[model samples]
Target chain A: MSSHQAVREGAKQVVRLLEKFPEEKFKYLVSFKATQLERFSRIAGIPLPKKLATEVPGENKTSINEIKDIVNRTSGPLGLQKDMLRKMQAAIPHDQFTESAMKDQITALSNLVNNKYKNYYDVGDKLYKPAGNPEYYQRIIDDIQGKKKENILAGLRTVFMGR
Target chain B: MLKCTARKSSLNTVTKLYGINAAKTYNYNPVSLYSTTNKNLQADQKKQTELEFDTHGSPIVRGQKSTIPEYKLPKWKEALGEYVIKTFGLDMDKIRAGPVAGSYYYSICKEQGLQYENEPLSDSAKFFYEDLKLPKTFSQWFQITALHEWMLFVRMRAMPFKYGRNYQQKLVDKTFSDIEMRLFDEMNIHSGRIVDQYSKDFNSQLKGAVFAYDVGFYTDDTTLATAVWRNLFGGRKNIDYTHLDAVVKYIRSQLYVMSRMSDREFALGKFKFVPTKEKINKLSAQEEEEMKQKIIKKYEELDKSGLLLPSDKSNLSYDN
Candidate 1:
C-alpha cells in the first residue's frame, strides 16, 4: 500500500481507538507515531521516499539470462570472474528461499556482472595486445636478422633485391 | 558521281617523280633490338645448372651460406629404376619444372623395402595422429597438412644437396598424386582433367609455401604470427593477437624441432610434430639438448639396423 493510503488508514484506526478508549493516555503514543513518520519523511538532504512498491518489474530468471548475455559480450575484455549467473545459480541453496537472501544474491550477481562492464567502460574501446611468447619472438628476430645479413645479402651479392 | 581519276603510284614511280626528296631513308640504326642477356659470361651453363638443381631439389642453402649450390642429383637409373620409362633418363621439360615436378612420377610408388611399407624393418617410427590432436575442420586440417608439408620443405632445404632434391621431388610428387587421386576417386572428376587442377593447386601451394617460409622461416614472430593468421587462420582480421602469438610460438617451435631432425628421419617421414601443448621455446638448453640426445639415440638405434643412408657430411667448394 502507498504511504498516503496507509497513513489515512492508521488515522482512521486512531480515531476508532479514541472513540472506544475515551482516554488521553494513548494520545501521546499516537502523537509519537506521527512524529516518527514525519522524521522518516525527511532524510539527510533528500526527502525520504514513501513511494509504494509497484510489482517489482520482472522475474530474476529472465533477467539472469539477459545478465549472462551482457556478461558474454563485455566480460571478454574484463578477462576475469566469468560464468556469473551460472556460478551464482549453482551456489544458491535449494533448501531455503528467502526474499532478502535472493535479493542479496541478485545484488551480488549484478555487482559481478556490472563491474566488468564498468571496467570495460574505463578501458574504453582501445585495442588489446594478446599474450605471446617472448623467447619465441626473440628467436624470430634472431632468425630474420641472421637471414637478412647472411642469406639475403649472400643471394644479393651479384644481384640487389632491395630489402 | 565521283570518278577514280587519281592513279595509284608505285613506290618507284613516286620516288622517280619526287626525286631524292621523296625517297625514304633506309639507313639502319646501330642499336640492336635484343640486348645481350649474359653479355660475356657463360651464364647459360650456370642457369642450366641452377635450373637442374631447382628441378630436382629444394634450392635451400645453409642458413649461413649465400652461394647457390650446384645441380647434383642421384643417378637417373637409380632414381627412376622402378618407373617404366623406355628412352631418356629424365625429360628436359620435367627437369625444367624443377626437382619437385620431375620426381613426381617416382615419388608416388610406395617405397617397397622400407619397414613400414614392406615387412616390418623394426625401426619404423610410430607417430600416432591422435597424439597431436590435428584439427578436424577443413581449413585448419589443410593448415596442419600445410604445416607438415612446410616442415618437410624446411628439411628438404636444410638437406645436403643431392638427397634434398630427391626428397623434395618425392614429397611434391606424392602431393600431386594424392591430389590427383582425390579428384578422380573422391570428387568424381576424370583422371584426364586432374593434372590441370593439380598444376594450379601445386603452383598455388608452392607460392603459399614460399610466403610461409619467408614469413615463418626468416622473419620475427609477429610476422610469422601474421603469416600464420593469414594462411593458417584464413586471415580473420578480428582474430585475437594472443592466438596469433600462440600460432607464432607453435611455428617457431616446429621450425626449431624440424631443424634438429636428421635428413634420414625426414626422408623416412618419421619426424613427429611437437604437440601444440609442449612449447619448445619454454625448454631450457640442457633440457632441449637432452631431448635431442634422446632423438639421436633413437636414430642411432635405427642406424644400427642399417636403415639410414650415409649422406655426404663434408663441404664442397663451388665457384659461384
Candidate 2:
C-alpha cells in the first residue's frame, strides 16, 4: 500500500481500538502520564512516534485558564467570589456538590422557605421537608462556604501579609 | 389607473395584459389632459367669483409644502407581479437573506468596534478597546470588526451553499462600501488613489485573516488564539494572557450558541452576539429539546397564519 493509504489504515485501526476500549482500561490511560508511557515503551524496546514527545505550549492550559478567567469576570457582576461561581458545564456529568449546584440549591431552598438565609432552620416551614437529614444539606453548604471563605482570606493574606 | 393602462397599451403592442381594447383607450398624455381641464376649471371659477371681487389676494399658506400624489399598483397587479417573478423560478429567499445577512449582520459586527470622536464608547466597544486594552486607532477598529465578521462567516458557512455564497458576497460588498464612506468622511482622505490603496491593503489583510481563522476553527483553541493574537492584537509582545484567554472564550461561546441555532432562525437574522459580561452555560439536553419544540411551534403557527409573503418564505429548517 502507498504511505497515504498506510496512514489511513493506521488511523482506522486506532479508531477501532478506541471503540473497544473498556471503561476500566480507559481509567488507567487517564491517570497515565506521558513520562510513564515513555518509560513503558522503552522497557518494551519499541520506538515511539516523534509527535508523541512534542509539547505544545498552552495546549492543556487554555481550558483551565478559560474557565478561571470566565468565572473571575462573571463573579464581579454577580457579587460572588471567583471560587464560588460554578459554571455548571453541560459537557460534564452533573455533580450536585459543585459550586453551581450549591448555588441553585440555595436559591431554590431560599424561595421555598421564604427566608433570605440559605440554612436549615429557615427551612423549618411546613412546606419544606428534608429527604434524608436537613443538617446534612446544611453541612455541605457550610463546608463549601467555609472553605471558599478561607480561600478568599488566604488570597488576601498573601497580598497584605508579606513573606 | 385608466391612464396607466392607456399609456402601456399605446406604448407597447405586447401589453395585452393591460386591456383588450387598445384603440378605444385615449392615447393623450395624462399630465397635459389634466392641465387643460384645470385651466378650464379656473377660468369658470374666475368668472363665478367676479361678482365678489375683493382687494386681498389669495391667502399665503405657511409651512405647508406641496404634496405630490404617489401611484400604487392595484392588489391584483401586485399579486400578478409576484406571480410572474415566481413563475420564472427566481430565488426569493436568497434575495431576502442578502439584506438580513449582509446589511444587518455587518451592522452588528461593525458596532462591536465602532467608535466616534468626542463620544463615550458603547458597552461592547469598551470591552474590546478599554478592557481588552487594544489601541483606539482606525486600523485597530478594522481588526476588531474583521474578527467579528469572521465569526459570523463561520455560521454563514453552515447555511445552504448558494444562499450562503450570496450572503457572503453581500456582506463583503457592504464592508467595502462602509470602508470607502469612512475613508472619505471620517479619515478625510479626499484623494481617490490613496483610498483605493488603503482599501486594497485592508482587503488583502481580511483575506489572510479569514484563512487563518478558518484553520484555527477547524484545528484547536491554541491555533485560534494564535490567530487572534496575530491579527487582532497585531502580534505585540506586551499582550496580556488574560485578554487573549477571554477573547478565545468569547469566540467559543459565540460559536457554541450559533451552532445550536437553526438555519431558518439564523437566515432571518435572529442571531445576536453573547455579550462579554454574560456567561453562556451549556443547555441541558432537555432544555435543548424544549427549545427545538418551541421553534417548531413558532414557525408552524406563522406558516398556518399565511402572513409571510412568498419572498419571506424559506426552505431551511426551524427545528434543526
Candidate 3:
C-alpha cells in the first residue's frame, strides 16, 4: 500500500481500539488516537476520516458492548449500579433487545467476566443510550427526511426548470 | 378844637396897641408864652404834613466793607503738601531720597513748583516705591526695574514649552509614550519616527501657549483657551493623532455604508477635511510661496473675467 493508505488504515485501527475500551480506558485511548491521527495526517497530507475519530452509533458494536459491560459491573457500587441499569434499560431498543433478555445476558456475563472487566459495562451503558432510544432515533429520522425533502425540491427546481 | 389857657399877666403889654382891645389879655410874661407858642406850633406842624424824608443813609451799610477783611492766598507748596497728605496719606519722610524726593523737597522749601504739583502720586507707582518697601539704594531700585522689564520680555517671547502647555503637556507626554507601544500595530511607522514626530509637533504647537496667554491678557477669548488646551494635550503628539485615526476610520466606514446605499450619493457627497492651524503652519516654505502665487494668479484671473470686486485687488500682495 501507499504511505497515505497506510496512515489511513492506522487511524482506523486506533478508532477500533477505542471502541473496545471502557469509558475511562477509552478516554486515554482517544487521546492516543488523536496524537496518532495528527502524525498520520502530517505524513498523508490530509485530515483523518471523521468516522475514525467520532463515536458512530449502531455501526460501532464493540463500543456498545463495552459500555454495557461497564454498567453491569458497576451496579453494586452505591446506587450507581441501579442508575446505570436504568440508563441502559432506557437506552437499548426494546423490540431488538428486550430489557429482561439483556438483564439475563448481563447476569450470565457477570459470572464469566473478571471484576476488572466489569467497568466496561458502565461505559457501554453511556455510549448506547442515544443510539438505542426511540426518541433519539425518531429525531434523527425526522432530520434525514427533512433534508431529503429539501434536496428533492432543489433538484426539481434546478433540473426540471434548468435554473 | 384847640384848648388854651391864657394868663392875665400878658394883658398889660398889648393894652396900648389897640384901644378897642385895651381890655384884652395881651400882656405877656415872655417865658410862659414862648413855651406855649412853641407847643402850639409843633401841634400844627404834626397835623399839616402828609409825607416825611431823610437826607442821611444807614450806618450798617456804611460799615459793610470794613467788617470782613480780604483773604491772602496760601503758599502753593504748602497747599500742595496738604493736598498730597489728604489724597494719598503718603508719609513724605520715607520718599525723601535722591532726585525725585529732593526735587519735591526743594519745591516745598523754595515754593517754586506749580500750584497743583503737590497732588498725590499714582497708586501703582506709589505702591511700587513705598508699599512694596523697595530697597532705598539706587542699585536695588534698578534691579527691581530690570526684573519688571525681564518679565515683560518673557511675556512677549514665543518659546515652546519642553513638554506641553500647563496641565496638558504632562497628559500629552504620557499619552504619547502609551501610544508608542501600539504605533507599530496600528500605523506601520517606526517607533523612533513616531516618537520624534510627537516630540517635534508637541514643541511646535506649544508655542501657541504664548498666544493663549496673550489672548487671555487682552480679549479674554475662549477660542484661544481651547487652543491652549489643544497645544498641551490635543496636538499631534497627544490624543489628536489617535482621534484623527478614529475619525479617518469612521469616515472610511461611513463612505462604505453610503456607497452601499447609493453610488450617486457617494459620488456627489463631500467629506470635511479641517486641517489644523498647526498643520497649515507646517506646510513647506515652498508650498506657502506656491500658495501666494496661486492667490495672485486667481486674482488676475478674476480681474480678466471682470469678476473681481472693486478694491479687492488693490492690496493683494501676499504676507509671508
Per-model TM values vs. the true structure: 0.35, 0.51, 0.13
Q: Return the lDDT, model 1, position B157.
A: 48
- The TM-scores that each candidate's chain B achieves against the reference are 0.47, 0.73, 0.17
lDDT of 2 at B166: 69
Better of 1 and 3 by DockQ: 1
Ranking by TM-score: 2, 1, 3
Candidate number of the best lDDT: 2
By lDDT, the candidates rank as 2, 1, 3
In model 3, state the lDDT of residue A69: 79
Q: Which ten residues in a row have the lowest lDDT in candidate 1 chain A?
A: A123-132
Lowest lDDT 10-residue stretch of candidate 3 chain B: B155-164
Better of 1 and 2 by TM-score: 2
Chain A (alone) TM-scores for all candidate structures: 0.19, 0.18, 0.19
Recovered native contacts in candidate 2, as a fraction? Answer: 0.00
Q: After superposition, how far is residue B168 of candidate 1 from its true place, in Å?
A: 1.4
Candidate 2 backbone collisions, by pair: none
Instruction: List each candidate's DockQ score.
Output: 0.01, 0.01, 0.00
In the range A13-55, model 2's lDDT, one tens digit per residue, is 3223222222221111121123323433342344544644453
